[model samples]
Target: MKRFVLLVVVAGLAGGGYYAYRNQRAGTQQAQASAVSGPRAVPVEVASVETMTVNEEVEALGTLAADESVIIASEIAGRVVALGFKEGERVKAGQDLVKLDTAILDAELKQALADLGLARDTNERLRALVQRGSGTQVALDESTARLASSEARVQLAKAKLAQSTIVAPFSGVVGLRSVGIGDYVSVGKPLIVLTSIDPIKVDFRVPEIYLSRVKVGQPVQVRVDAVPDRTFTGQIFAIDPVVDVNGRAIRLRANVPNGDLALKPGLFARLSITVDQRENAMVIPEMAVVPDGVGKMIYVAENGKARRVAVELGKRLPGKVEVVGGLKPGMQIITAGQMRLRDGSTISVKEKPVQTSQL
Candidate 1:
């Protein structure tokens, strides 16, 4: 009876040990399988790469200026007798703006004319006498000299009279007048300011590195704070040949039509110049670009795995970036949830991949 009880206890102990060993082995096998399979799939949102028309552009700040500007001044000293133009009115070229008192100049001209007449009569009489042999040759020569001096005096008097009237040099808007009627003005005194606004100009500067790209007749888009709702278009008309050593930039000027006189001189301007255009350019959302050290990197979805790639970037547009190299059209790029991804990481797209047109 004692031996039977001992045998039964040994059998139970062996069975329990065998069962424990099987459970331990199974757990180890499961762990090994998990290790070989790697981490779970990462959820991400992706957008497909596509081609589009892209413009290579350069941005800069500038200032609006009048096409033509000048301060009108007097060329001779006189009392202002008549004012021909109203303040702030447009004046035509050669239209008189100011007329000085010409009374003294008129009297001077008449006196010179009278002297000229007297000298001519004397010269004629002397020539007649010399031809008749009644006067000396020396006397006739003196009379001729006197006639020439009188003619010069008359021309000088006429010029002084013409100078009394100041006319517009070009068609432009006139500013305030400094001298009023009956006011005496000296030579070079400020009379008014004139500015031509139609076909206004903008002055801007760009980096010298773009010298080869910039050219005359390139289109430019301009905007100003004063005219927030309007965008002005123009073409580059002039470029400074010398580059500024201090700023390493080249100056440029463009002409914008202002027929309505909306643009004025000295207004601040913002300018964009289109340097080049590409018909088919590969682009992706800017959010997909990941900064990798000094270069740029992005993750592409391939066969349910994230493949990291290095890319060379070109021009950057609003919310998009141009991929110059290392990318092709129709490839899906991770736009969001890429933080947890590594090279060859398994990915689970949360939604249908967005098309390039949708972006």
Candidate 2:
């Protein structure tokens, strides 16, 4: 009777365990089915497609330069006796900047003048004697030649005296002076640097494909790293007819007004040349563009789902990009949270679709 009771208890325990395990399995399957049938919507931020005029721009890097730059140098060797202007002072054209010692030059000029006077007196006296038949013709000719020679010497001396004074060639501000008073400087030695700052220049290059687009008088917008908060405007003043063999680009020059003298030479600058303009162009936020294989794409919210679209791109603005095809105005493009989405995925807008500005 004890063996019979033990066998019955073991069979009841096995049956109860199997029934509980089966119920748990069925519950798990039902939960999985529910999960598969209903999925959560992806939360995203969106922007509306816009229509506006867009400029086709060619971007390039260049350096700010002076409108006219020159290093003032000595034309003749001399000892600096006086500095007429202070360093970093604005000077007018032909303003005296430096004065060399003129003691020796003065003495030489005086001697030449005395010689010329004496030669003229002698020549006149000789001519009078020849008219009276007292002086030979050869004597008169020799005296006339001496007079000519003496006059030339006087003119030469005058030129040398003028060299003692060094003046500014143009209106500009003078840079640091390398030679001070009492310093001996040789010909061709640098004295100071003068640069015209009212109207500055910038030299840059662009690809040859834009040769037709870039022309004289085309407007340009320039920005420099040194002057981060400021933007300078200019226009194309010149262009090189020849293309660079190595870069396959054409060099260009633009003229920018700097009446305040804020812009400086040699500062690195970035510029955009407006080559073409499109009226009523379709544009979208640049952040909305997504890489789709070798092309580009964007996600648009439509009918409570995400619609993946491939786009043909055009000009790129500051914060926006031009859409050439595959998109239209009034579409809500997902600008944020697009990485977690797929085609036809359910989407819940995190906020109202924001309108983009013309950038």
Candidate 3:
């Protein structure tokens, strides 16, 4: 009985030792898991806040127009005897474009001159007789009236003769002719279209909210799908004083040089106007900005930790933004891997430091 009792006590002690060993091992494993699951540094890409020239620009759509455009028309009715300019040819101001049959007009002018000469001779004879007191004042007055009437006829006849020739009012390129030689044209007949296109005009509109910021002489950059690879530069020349009631926008016009005539009238254009510019402005990549409530925030790396800072943004460029406030030059701002970051969270940069120029 004593031997059996000692064995039972020894088994109890062994069971207690086993339970203690299992508890110790569990506690060690839990501690090791806690150590392994501790918070780790987040990997991110960072870029330095830089200072450079930045432009505050406004974008708008526009249509190109010729500097001057008009439709050539005849003022008198006659048969076209000659065409001075070929289709699509450039002509100078005062260059003749068409000549009408002037035979009838020339004959009328000759008759008017003959009558004028006869009236003048009679008026001289009447004046000499009146001075000698041999002619009545009434007779002299009648001759004087005839002479004035004849002179007026001659002036009218000369004007009609001159109108038989159609001339270019301004230097421009002519479109297809509406009437060919030997085609009879009437008064106010449409002949052709003339366009002056060397320095083209661009018509665009912007929201009225930008009216205060825009001004004459502001630089504008123009692009068109037709000329995809080239950009045209121009200056603002006109602005409408009244805002458009239907669209709540203001109209503006710019003049751009097209020396090579590559830009055509009526082409759709995209324009960017640089209303303002800042030199040595603080700039950073747009990816660094984070929306926080109604304001904006950015994660800045300082001393191996991230600091969420509220920033005031200025102008925005392609993949870049102007930091008007809340940042200084040479400060590193998080560009990527910001989703897992919190204020005061540790960070490990995954890439080399980025610069604004590199973006």
Please give, for residues 93-170, the per-residue lDDT of candidate 2 as tens digits: 999998998888889999999999999999999999999999999999999999999999999889989998999999
What global local distance difference test value does model 2 have? 0.92
| Models ranked on lDDT | 1, 3, 2
The lDDT values for all models are 0.94, 0.92, 0.94
- Which candidate should be chosen as best, given TM-score against the real structure? 3
Per-residue C-alpha lDDT of model 3 across residues 152-204, encoded as one tens digit per residue: 99999999999999899998889988899999999999999999988999999
Pairs of residues at least 3 apart in sequence or in different chains that clash in candidate 3? none
Tens digits of per-residue lDDT for model 1, 1-359: 99999999999999999999999999999999999998789999999998999998899999999999999899889999899999988899999999999999999999999999999999999999999999999999999999999999999999999999999989989988888999999999898998998899999999999999999999999999999999999999999999999999999999998988888899999999999999889999999999898799999999999999999999888899999999999999999988889999999998865568753
RMSD of 3: 4.5
Model 1 clash pairs? none
* TM-score of each model, paired residue for residue: 0.79, 0.70, 0.84
Quote the lDDT for 42 in model 2. Answer: 93
Per-model tally of clashing residue pairs: 0, 0, 0
Model 2, position 233, has a per-residue lDDT of: 97
Model 1 residue runs over 4 Å out of place are: 1-44, 303-305, 345-359
